[model samples]
Target chain A: MRRVLGVVGLLLLWEGLAAWGLLNPLYAPPPHQVLLTLYGLFQSGEILPHLQATFTAALLGLFWGVLLGGSLGLLAAFSPLFADMLEPIMLLLNAIPRVILAPLFVIWLGIGLASKVALSLVLVSVLLFFAVYGGVRNVDPRLVERVETLGGGRLWLLKEVYLPSLAAWVLSSLKVAVGFAFTGAVVGEFVAASRGLGYLLSFAQSTYNAKLSLALITLIVLFVLLLFFLFDRLERHLLRWRPRGRAESQA
Target chain B: MLRVENLTLGYGGVPVLEGVSLGVGEGEFVSLVGPSGSGKSTLLRAVAGLVRPRAGAIHRAFPPEALGFLFQEDALLPWRTARENAALGLRIRGWPKAKALEEAEAWLLRLGLQGLGDRYPHELSGGQRKRVALAQVLALRPRLLLMDEPFSSLDAILRTGVTRDLLRLVEGEGIAVLLVTHDLEEALALSDRVYLLSQGPRARIAKEYAVPFSRPRDPVGVRSDPRFGPLLRRLWQDLEEVALCAAS
Candidate 1:
């Protein structure tokens, strides 16, 4: 209830400023106008194809990113030689600004979904790779010893200890990865694309339709927020073993 | 069932235990008591095959997997429920999930942790978690148990209760045990024999005492027995001498 009121309060302040012309109308469209533009865009069904394209690209990128990064991280953790040889190279690659690759990806894959996905994959994978690598590396040695003494082999150790420990890290990184995936897709589309929310954004900018651009931006924010909320709930469900603050204090 | 002949163990090229010999016969309970940093834990680790001896051998009648070790800390996996933690050993041994869980549930009940199989370690009290640890080890049906101050973190009252419960269960199962602890009373209450290790720079067993108390004895009652005070005093004198010798 308080959160809802806070959002409402912010929107009212924005509306009051726009109504009184305290804000420049040409640069900052009113909240109501942006909402109406958003409604109209949806009603005209002009946004669906772009939305679908962006969603498919982001989802595919996220899928491949998590799979490849998580597997490689696990492999690196188990093989010291591999880690020693490859970890530095991975770090070097990750150090470079990945967004700079958007144009290169577009040049190679053309101005299509493939370029968007390839860009998003690079962005999301680096974040996930480091998260998983660190997670696997930091599992408690005592736990590993305990498993070993119980007649567990390397496969058993991986299944019982390493995987569960890595799961937590991966899940936590998923929130960041979701945003990165979306950002990668949008930015790739913004740089050069035929259709996407980012293309619409660029179109609105070229046409000087501030309300349309703001409306598209609002939709994108809402979409990302919704995904983040779902991921938060998933995290809570998976990590039910964690004691809540209230329970800890009471104990 | 286990013998450590002149065990010399260390870590990082620094000697911790020097020429320490010990034995735990079939169904025997032995405790190693020592001052802090005296390598009692190192000795236990050596016997458990976690630490390699520099120039000694440990012989066991049972195989490696037939020995269970409980760390000083609870060491329960925070992510796993009580049942899962207890069942870990069985699962590692390739038992199916249903059978492992069934046996783990039985052991939990036997350890007086009824209805706690679903609770995580954080939700359990200190004593309850200790019992869960015990269940985890005992579920393996180990021929020998190596424990390093398993109840040292508990309050005095809780410690006594856990010690009593452990004594009863281990005695009933006839499993040999080698325990490391700082508390002389805990040693006397639980073990058939107690060995005291001197402080390091090359710590070694300074003395050994056989407890005269009979089996199935209550930990609280054994502490108050007529013989208890005299035994404690004698062990304290021996420890004091070892401390003095180390100081000199």
Candidate 2:
């Protein structure tokens, strides 16, 4: 309740700032005008086609990220040789600012949603891989040894022991990765292509329609919040066994 | 029968025990007693096949798959409930989940852990966790059980309860046991024979005493028996010299 109040207060403060001329009226429209423009844009269905393109890219990117990241993380956790082999390449790729690759992806994939999806996948997969790999590596060896001495084989160890221990870590990384999911999509749109929230922002910029741009930014914020809320619920359900106030046990 | 013929144990290149030979006949309860770092645990680990014996063969009537080990630490999986942790050994031994859990519940009930199955390890007290660990091993019904200081961590009151529970299980199951402990009282309470190690990087068994106490002993009552204190004192006196040597 207090957190919600704090957010509402911030929005009112932003509106007052524009009303008082503390921020430029053209650049930072009043909240009322932004909401009105958002309503008009939605009524005209101006957001749909671009939203479909962006949503498709984000969803596909999320799928690729989870699949590739889960496999890579498992490999890294179970095989030191594989981790060592991939270390340098992963480091080099991660070192490059991913946002810079947006234009390159556009050039390569020809300014379609594929470029956006590719960018999102690259950023999210790396994050997920490390999160899950570290989580699995950090499992208590005493527990593993107990399982082993009791006659649990390697496959059993992976399925029952390692996977459960990694659950909380993987989900936390997913929460963080979801935010990056949107960033990847938007950056890909900003660098090139004809559709997405980023394209809508660009359209408002060219027309000097600050109200519409602010409204679009508000819409993106809500979209990210919705994604976060959904994942938070997922995290809660999956880790319900964990001690409350800490990472719950997935087992 | 479990036989250790001139067994030696080491980690990497550092030898902990050398030429240590012992045997636990079927259904025998033997205690390996010594000062700290006396390689008692190394011997237990060797029997469990967790630590490779550097220079001898260990032959067991049953395969390694049929062995059970209870560590000094509980080693219960924190992520699992007490029942689940207790049932883990049976599950790993290829028992179906339902049967494993049923067997686990029986053991837990026998160990005085009824109504605590749903609790995780962290939720239980130290003594409760140890009981759960004991239940875990017993659930597997191993022909040979290797325990390393299984009751060394408990408070005196808790230790008494755990000791009583352990003695009862060891006798009831008709399983062979090789236990390592620094506590002479514990060895006297649980074992048919007590072997004291000399101590150090190459600790050797210095003395073996066959406990004279009869079966189904009460821990406190056994201690009160006229012979118990003197026997314990005599063993400690002999161990003092070895303790000093190992310390230096």
Candidate 3:
């Protein structure tokens, strides 16, 4: 309740500032203008195709990113040889802002859904890989030994210990992964694309349409927040065993 | 039956135990008591096959799968309920989930964790969690149990309560136990024999006492026995000397 009010208060403050011309209306339009444009875009259904395009790309990338990153993390944790081979590569990838690959992906995969999905996948995969990788490595040795002494083989260790431990790390990372997926999709679309929220954003920027740009940005924020809320519910359900306040707040 | 012959254990390059030989006969309860950092746990872990013996042989009449180890740290999986954590071993051994959980729930009930099978490890109190861990190890039906101060974390009252159940179940099952502890009364009260280890860097079995307590001993009742005091004092004095020797 308090958080909602804080957001509302900030928007009203922005409205007052921009309407008073203390803030440049050309760059930072009044909150009402952006909100009205968002409503109009939806009412006219002009944003629907772009929304669908970005969402499809983002969701597909999220799915494959989680799968591939989690598997790679497992491989690295279980085998030193793989860790030796993969660590440097991941470090290099992570060293730079992953969004720079948007242009490269566009050139290779073409200015289509493939390029956008590829960018999102790479972003999410790197972030999730480290989360799961570190999670497996950091599990208590006593727990591992207890499982072993209890006659749990490698398979049981994976099921009983590794996967459950990974779930918390993965879920927490899934939140950030959500944000990264959108960034990747939008950035890829902004660089080059026939359709997407990012392309609309580029159009708004090219036409010097601050209101339209603000509406698209607002739309993106609203959709990402919606996804974050859904993932939060899923995480709460799955990680119900976690001690209260520690897991979610830390993330 | 188990025999650890001249066992030597170390972490990294530092020797924790040296030439520590110990044995536990079938159904006999043995305790290894020593000062803190005296390598009692090192020996226990070595016997449990977790640590490689630097120079020794551990011969076990039972198979590796028949060994149960209870650690000082709560080894229960945090995400799992009491019954699920207890059932882990059973599930690992090819028991179906339903059958495993049924057996685990039965064990939990026996350990006085009645109807709390669905509670997570964090939900349970420290003593309750210990009982669940005990149930987890015991549910495996291990013929030989290696416990590293499993009840040392509990208060005396909670310790006695859990020890009482542990004693009853271990004796009833005819399972052999090798308990590692620093608590003199706990050592003297619970086991048929107590082995004291010297101070560390290169620790070894310094003394072994035959605790003359008879079969099916009550952990609390044994403390009140006439001989419990004298032996405890004697061991305390010996431990003081060991601590002094290490200090020097």
Residue-level lDDT of model 1, residues A1-251, one tens digit each, is: 99999999999999999999899878898899999999999999999999998998888999999887787787787789878876997798699989899999999999999999999998888888899899987899878887877788998888878887777788889998999999999999999999998899899999999999999999988999899889888877777787787333522
Instruction: Quote the lDDT for A215 in model 1.
Output: 97
DockQ each: 0.70, 0.57, 0.83
- DockQ-based ranking: 3, 1, 2
State the lDDT of candidate 3 residue by residue for B1-248, as single tens digits.
89888887896787888888889999999999888898887788778777788788999998887888888898789999999998888888889989999999999999999989999888899999999999888998999998988877899789889999999999999999999888888889889999988889898888899999887878887888899999999999998888899999
Among the numbered candidates, top TM-score falls to 1
Best by lDDT: 3
> Which digits, one per residue and each the tens of the lDDT, describe model 3 over residues A1-251?
99999999999999999878899888898999999999999999999999999999999899999888888989999999999998899999999999999889988999999999999999999998899889998887877887887877898889888898889888888999999999989998999998999999999999999999989988889888998899999998888898877765864
lDDT values, one for every candidate: 0.88, 0.85, 0.89
Candidate rank order under lDDT: 3, 1, 2
DockQ of candidate model 3? 0.83
Clashes of 2: 2
The predicted structure with the larger DockQ, 1 or 2, is 1
Whichever of 1 and 2 has more lDDT, that candidate is 1
Ten contiguous residues with the weakest lDDT in model 1 chain A: A242-251
The true-versus-predicted C-alpha distance at residue B223 of model 1, in Å, is: 1.8
